[model samples]
Target chain A: MQDPFVRIEGVSKLFGAFQAVRDVNLTVGKGEIFALLGGSGCGKTTLLRMLAGFEEPSAGRIFLDGQDMTGVPPWERPVHMMFQSYALFPHMSVEKNVAYGLKHERMTKAEREERVRAMLDLVQLTQFAHRKPHQISGGQRQRVALARALARQPKLLLLDEPLAALDKKLREQTQFELMSIQERTGVTFIVVTHDQEEAMTLADRIAVMDKGQVRQSGTPTDIYEYPNSRFVAGFIGSITSFDGRVTAVEGEVSRVDVPGLGTEIVARSVAGAASGQAVTVALRPEKVTLTRDRLEGPNAIAGEIKDIAYFGKDSLYRVTLPSGQLIAVHGVNAKRAEAGRPDWHDKVWLSFDPAAAILLTE
Target chain B: MRRRPIFLISVLCFGFAFFYIPILSMIVYSFNGSRLATVWGGFSTKWYVSLFSNRQVGAALLLSLKIALISATMATILGTMAGIALARFRRFKGRLFFSGMVTAPLIMPDVITGISSLMLFILMAEWIGWPATRGFTTITLAHITFSMVYVTTIVQSRLISAERDIEEAAMDLGSKPWQVLWDITLPVIFPAILSGWLLAFTISLDEVVITSFTTGPGNTTLPLLIWSKVKLGVTPDINALATIIVLVVGIGVVIAGWLMNRAEKQRDRDARLAYRANE
Candidate 1:
């Protein structure tokens, strides 16, 4: 973040009476893969389009590498986009598509061909260079779109829902492939995606947008662990939150009286929360431990195991407290078959460390 | 195949007989050796030979072909520009009115279009003093004015189904608006434009009322000549000319159909390739 390569300054877009993006400001560093992650109709795509010069902000300004992008046409800007549909020209071959942007550059024919070959090789599509887009699979088409967008060597690249079309396996594989490509090319990428996991895996930093405003902007870990609002916490991952009031505040800890848990829980004290203030205590499933051993803490409670969703490497155990509220706890299935594992309807003790709970007062 | 109902079969036969009987009779009478009208004679190729060498037929045919070709090409260009403007430029002053005017000629009666264009040409001649003689140029202008409507409709409908992302992608890749149009938009809609040209060409070739209104002395198109000849009296040579016209047009249609089929086959192959790509 030393040098801000792409800076969006108080950008806002309005479609007649509807405001699509509202007072959004962000800065992306060079060679960093930044993500604008949000759900549908959240203005994530709108912000990305504004950066690519497709839609000029109705208010505010955008700067790319110290150059003002206002009033510049998409073709004149030093940024390219990979559309969600990939948008490969059906009439053109893969090589031709990758080489499309190069035709206007002041390069020799040989240089253009060499650059195209290098790009095709980078996307691992050299063998299908002569094939049309429909002649290739969807995964290959996605790579072709990537290769085409990167061929121009612009100051930045915009990718909108880059891997939404692929199956789960291909999406996961392409997520890493995209990161590797970004590393190799050193081109700043602004990826817009609805998939939170995609943003977490592919981006160095993410801006989570909702309802035309940015909720939080930070690294993946920072946003997941230290979400500023309940919306961000719920949107980013699965977590059980309790409506509570802070009963007491001690050094670095707060005792919250949660009616949902019907217990006083000790959690990490969040800034700006005082005694008698309303706060929401959020606990992630993986942070809570399901054990039979006696745990001595206000954060511990005895509950009956209601359900268990078993994965190969891990299992999610849902325990219902006497207050009739269920809390999810994840346990790693390390041993092949454990002897003393609690079954359905078995009483179990659920404990979470005071530091693991996220206290929000928004 | 299951046996079709007698009523359906009879209706189909009656419909086809109603259409093809005139053409069949015309073809059959073209080889008549007798000079008297409606008199049957021995088979002979004299009318066909004479029709080929007739100077008036040649002149009219050449003029019709020239006007049709020029008008079709002009209509395709102008109509495609209008179509792209309507499709790409979503909002502009008088866009609705402009689009309405562009498509109005499509449903306008041919007589109205002909008379209006004729009056407009007269006014232009008196005011601007250009096109002093209304012959090939006047006929061509009138044909283009009407045929461009069909072209615009075709191009616009094709573009409705076209993916906007391709053109946006081209522009994002540094292609200017005009360049994007030329490299991406036009190619994507080339088939539509081509079909439009063919439609315009065929329309112009056979348009009788419009041609009759706009044409000047000594500038007879084939349709006008045929109309005049049939008015005078049906001749074996006229029948021969009709047969030749049908043969040429039928061959062109067959070729077009074959080409479209081949394109469809290519798409089928692409589908097979897509299936294979899974493995």
Candidate 2:
């Protein structure tokens, strides 16, 4: 097997007495877009900074293409970083900004110009060569920053919240554009972002971080479908959780009896738990089906509709189970609904597939 | 609500006259034809010509210009470095002590600084057998000691407002630390350094107390010459010299203002270009 493009081996960073990153180990395949997704102060940005050589790890080592980069400075490393603020030199023209790193590469003037022109064209900023950074709009500045970082043809590109400064509509469009650019260039990209949707849309794999450690690392589908912990399930998306005890285990499925909902739910469990062990069952709102009549399924609970949030394409129903547990059911807002809609205060049955209910042990 | 127009105009006129009357009188007396310093005979440029022709005044003006230029240039360089270091680097063991030492000259009386520097130079001369006498070198050194305090203060404030992330980003893009300093840090602080030089120059040129104590017989500066002339009773030639000095200072002020305006416009243009590029 070929080695990963970049490998982080037990990397840790400490600021004086406080540990900012703790025993983080991960690997990035060549040409893959990996995301470090977390909230503020979760060490995602710190990890990105360490990869860019701005911060040295207090413990462990990092390797890029099988070469150790433990004590190398940022300027000596073959990695480039796009700062969150898009730190473009305000005094230089766009062409000068993009060609800044090439000046030190011992290339001829013509070669430098050709490379700079190619990068500008790549980022779609060729016409603004003579203009300074301030003459451009926010999105244009972001592109210029990206072009500047890529001009050196770095082995790895680090983006610190690349689309964070843009508005909602622009952020969505730019996220797709960034993904396409990464795909086209075949450069290994490590994007650090706090936006879950941004991570889901752009990253081939994500390392969801909390506090200073990776809570979970997997594909977006795996993270969404089978979160290893309650924090991951709650942080990734909205989830309905129930306190329960395991009653039986059979192959890939486990039966959990939840007292509040007054039902036995068969859920997929990766973590082995003996019978009578306390656990939590997580179900996504969109996975639950709501109907007026009682339904027979692996997981079914009778409840009364408490409230309805009418979205354009989907409506969310908040149901109060007979055991006084609140659960949410998302219903499609189409002409032909999947199941009959239950009005507010009406008694209903909520049912979910056994495979959809994930048993979380953490 | 608007007040009475005449009342506002009257107040403005009063304020203008209160400031300009003495300066206008100095200019008027510069052209007086009479030898009696206070009484004017008629308008003539004889005193202006004599002011230029006088050997003592000429030498003093030259000495003052040389000292001011040299001292101000040195002060600006040292102060700018101090400012950049203080603003950009994190605090260390003696950071507070160093910052306090840089600013101490600003509040210390000129007489005290002049006397102390003179005494120190004398002691050094006794110990090392150098600086044979108090002269232009000592005066220039004295001027820089005080003027650098002001320059460092101004430059430090300007550097504090500049973003350090710009320099870090330059380094992140594979530029060395020196390159980042030259390209990003220097350009951002250039305006502050220029203005600080101008301020130091003007202060050194107009200094009197320190110059008086540190200067020898042949090293009298313009202010020192003017002080001596005042003791012998001021003449129309002195008025002519004063007017010329004021005119030169006015031109300097205008030039400084123009340079500051140009720098601000360039900064704005750069910011606009960045904004457009981001779009």
Candidate 3:
């Protein structure tokens, strides 16, 4: 957000007795695909609606391109949204639907038609321009919606669960198409989605939210590897957390005694974090390496594999420790379904380096 | 015939008989050549010829059409506005009272509404000196008042089920409020408005009690003429007139039914096509 194109300062929204969004401060850099990631009713959509001028913030101001967006109606704002339902006009053909927003602009009819043709071409939907929305496939309808929103060429674009309506394969293809379109248009995008994988794959940066508050905001890898809170780690990815207390603090590493695991854990510590303070030690599923033999590592625990789920390229093993706490370990199938892979009821050793375990004090 | 129960067949026969018997009897009697409505001397076209030649009946029919058309149009416009207000603005002062009063006409007795309107017209004439005599203008005003209630209720329910996000989408795409209504909302609800207008037109054309209470001497609508003719005696010409009215109404209902069915079929086909296109 060094050269911010859109800034939301201390924005909060309240619906009667329920506070939909807490005090939120965020800035999106120009031409960046920023995502607001959360569960249902976590205020991600409300924040997006506020940015599109559909909903007014109850207590704070929003600035777009250094101009205050206070009291500006949605029709006047230089922002547009691709709705979750698409909301394509049922009475209009695809060509007309894409040209709808241009009716208000001061342009000649020929120029408007040219712009619409270009937008349809950009989304690779020029062949289906004259078809009605329902006459096309779900994937084609989605492209029509994208084409319509981009036809306006607004300064900022908001997308609400753009791929939620499509099948899995179509959604994956649409994600890449959306990214390339954003790259070509150079329009700032703020997407709101409850699907964490979609956010990870499509976002340049993501803000993970919980209960009306932002827990963490960073690049996909940064948030995945170093989540700052227990909620962030659990929400963004699958993690097994244990209650522990800091026993000793080294310069950059700390040893914590966890009663749940019947062992002590070594994790990278926060600067100036004192010993004897209670904290939660979190380990991601894929971060823990599972093997048949015990490793000479700082963090290794023995567990019995209670369940095995094969997902073609990889497998998920639910391991039950001696203390009855189950830990999930994602094992990559390096060898093609060989006997060396761990199976149910097999005893295994799960090990991770000290840098892999995230230490959360809150 | 394929394993159909005898009891189900009897019920179906009973239902159709109950709906169609009265209309069938009326159409049959219209062909009666005798002056007595109950006695059929022979089939003849004399009654139809006399009915078409009557100047009084022709004038009344024309006046009725004019009143129905004007009232139905005015009612639809006002009703659409009221419906949108009630459906969109959730929190307004006196909303409960406003909605309750709007629907009161639907359930109120025609005698009560007619009499009450009569009194109001008299009072207005005394005070404002407008509507100097009650006739076409007074009758149309009264029809619009009651007919708009039906329009409002129909429009309100149709609008409630309409996708609200479409309007917000229009606004987000830089449409003004009026532009959004014209370009998006109204088109989505056009069929509802059309049905409402037709209902209003039918109610106005069929109403007699209200017209009687409000009409002056010269303005004789078709229903008023028929009522006066029936008082003298049920004439063969009146039977011919009634048969024509029933045929027109039956045709209208058939067309409307076909239109609604076709629209529903189109929607189903579109849904199927969308899925097929996916593969």
- CA lDDT scores, all candidates in order: 0.92, 0.89, 0.91
Residue B254 CA displacement from its true place in model 2, Å: 3.0
Clashing pairs in 3: none
**Any idea what lDDT model 2 has?**
0.89
Q: What DockQ does every candidate get?
A: 0.77, 0.56, 0.79
| Top-scoring candidate (lDDT) | 1
lDDT of 1 at B165: 92
Best by DockQ: 3
**Candidate 3, TM-score vs. the true structure?**
0.97
How big a share of the true inter-chain contacts is recovered in candidate 1?
0.85
B188, model 2: CA deviation in Å?
Answer: 2.2
lDDT for residue A207 in candidate 2, whole number 0-100: 98
Residue-wise lDDT of candidate 1 within B1-279, one digit each (tens)? Answer: 446687789999999999999999999999898875499888988998998889999999999999999999999999999898888896899999999999988889999999998999999999999789899999999999999999999998899889999999999999999999999999989999999999999999999999999999999999999999999899999999999999999999999899999989998899788768766
Query: Which structure among the candidates has the greatest TM-score?
Result: 3
Worst 10 residues of 2 chain B by lDDT: B270-279
lDDT of 1 by residue, A1-362 (tens): 57699989999999999999999999999999999999999999999889888898999999999999999999999999999999999999999999999998999999999999999999999999999888899999999999999998988999999999999998898999999989999999999999999999899999999999999999999999999999999999999988889999998899999885657889999898899999998989999988887587767888999999989788999889878988888999877765667789988888889999999998
Instruction: Give the per-residue lDDT digits (tens) of candidate 3, residues A17-86.
Output: 8999999888889999999999999999999999888889998999999999999999999999999999
TM-score of each: 0.96, 0.93, 0.97
Locate the minimum summed-lDDT window of 10 residues in model 1 chain B. B1-10
Displacement of the residue A302 alpha carbon in candidate 1, Å? 2.9
Which runs in model 3 stand beyond 4 Å of their true positions? A336-339, B1-4
Candidate 2 lDDT, tens digit per residue, B22-41? 99999998999998888989
